[model samples]
Target: MRLGECRQLRVKDMDVERRQILARDGRGQKDRITLLPEKAVTILR
Candidate 1:
């Protein structure tokens, strides 16, 4: 996702506390939460 989009994501929309990324698809028709790897999360932080 783009930085702008990421910024638009709210804390409630995130599953970070659960080690996941809740994202909407390009068409905005689908939503899902995907697991994030520990290393990637550390780097992003």
Candidate 2:
């Protein structure tokens, strides 16, 4: 993901059970869903 996307992430954007992240205002000003890297799970929690 881009640095901007990461910076915009909020706690509510995380779906830990599904290991997903909702990236808002992304490319073309559209929203998208992306997989959360397994390595980041623990840190995010």
Candidate achieving the largest TM-score: 2
Q: How far is candidate 2 from the true structure (C-alpha RMSD, Å)?
A: 1.1
Tens-digit per-residue lDDT, 20-41, candidate 2: 9999999899999999989889
What is the C-alpha lDDT profile of model 1 across 1-45, one tens digit per residue?
Answer: 545446556666655457787766533556666677788667767
In order, candidate lDDTs are 0.63, 0.93
TM-scores of the models, in the order given: 0.48, 0.84
Residue 20, model 1: lDDT of: 83
Runs of candidate 2 exceeding 4 Å displacement: none
Error of 1 at 37 (Å): 0.8
- For candidate 1, the TM-score is 0.48
Give every collision pair in model 2: none
